[model samples]
Target: MPDLLVEHHGVQVLVCSADGATIATEQDALDHLVGAAFQGAELVAVPAGRFDDRFYDLSSGVAGAILQKLANYRVRLAVVGDISHHMGTGTALRDLVREANRGRDIWFVTDLNELTTRLAPRP
Candidate 1:
């Protein structure tokens, strides 16, 4: 299936295909951001696997660059998938995930279900 625009809890999101081209550079990430914005998406949800492995490595600076670009445009991002392997690699990754999850701009979730839950409206 192709990337699609979906609504959850009244917010429009661009859900990227898991099998799509890997985002390995800042330009690749910018492409997705522009596409999502064109589709009127308030947020973009990309399968964690779609991101290059370097993204999970803080020293590589890929994640920070991509996320900063998105945040600069006020576009929220949700990385969806199981990243336990990456998390187990180091405390930096684990801490980053923990911190990102606590913010409204970025989130690291296990799956779409968890993404949905996080986007759900609360009383």
Candidate 2:
């Protein structure tokens, strides 16, 4: 079974299944998110490495599944890396990611400190 890792991003940032592969099925992804999203941790980082290598490329269904799961939670997600490489490949995918990012709920940031400001507690 895969394990979840709570990392220190100057604050608590739970990273789910660091060594786990990209979710094989939609159900598996959703179930995992249910347990992974809320760790009582203030910040949650979704490392591309946690998912499939293709996550950057996002050619597989895992990408969409992950996004859908995040939306269900109505919670924000922080991606701790640069996605220019993948986004550069296709206009559609780039647009999709860019649009998704436009919403404050999803962030693709290179630094973790930025998370604190973006994910501040609602009250």
Candidate 3:
């Protein structure tokens, strides 16, 4: 299945299929970013399963590189799916998820419903 364009609360989101290409490198991240931007998407919703395992390992720097690139391009991102397995006790991944969620630029949500709620208009 290919990535899809969807709308939630008036926000255009590029929702990547869970079975789509695995994002394991900065180039892969850029590919998604470019595609989303081309489609005029305000955000990119990527399933957690679409990411490579290295993405969950903070030391690998894959997450930071991908996220920073997206932020630099002013592209919002929502990682949609449970990532609890990656968040072990005292893990940097957990801290990263917490910090990212506090901002509008990036988020780690459990599902599309959560993403929808997050995309709802703010008062």
Could you say which candidate leads in TM-score? 1
Measured on C-alpha atoms, candidate 1 has an lDDT of: 0.88
Clashes of each: 0, 0, 0
Encode model 1's per-residue lDDT on 1-123: one tens digit a residue.
889999999989899898888987878887866555668899899999999999999889999998888877788999999988887777999998889999888999888989999999888
Q: After superposition, how far is residue 49 of candidate 1 from its true place, in Å?
A: 0.5
Which order, best to worst by TM-score? 1, 3, 2
Better candidate by lDDT, 2 or 3: 3
Which pairs of residues collide in model 2? none
Residue pairs with backbone atoms closer than 3 Å in model 3 (clashes) = none
Which lDDT tens digits does candidate 2 get at residues 1-123? 454445452445666545655555556555565456665644457655555555555567566777777678664567766666667677867777678667766677765565556555556
The order of the candidates by lDDT, greatest first, is 1, 3, 2
Prediction 2 TM-score vs. true: 0.63
Tens digit per residue, CA lDDT, model 3, 1-123: 787898899989998888878899888988866555668888999999989999999898999898888888788999999999888745699888999999988999999999999999989
- Model 2 gets an lDDT of 0.60
Local accuracy by lDDT, each model: 0.88, 0.60, 0.87
Off by over 4 Å in 1: none
Q: Model 2 off-target regions past 4 Å?
A: 1-25, 41-43, 57-59, 120-123
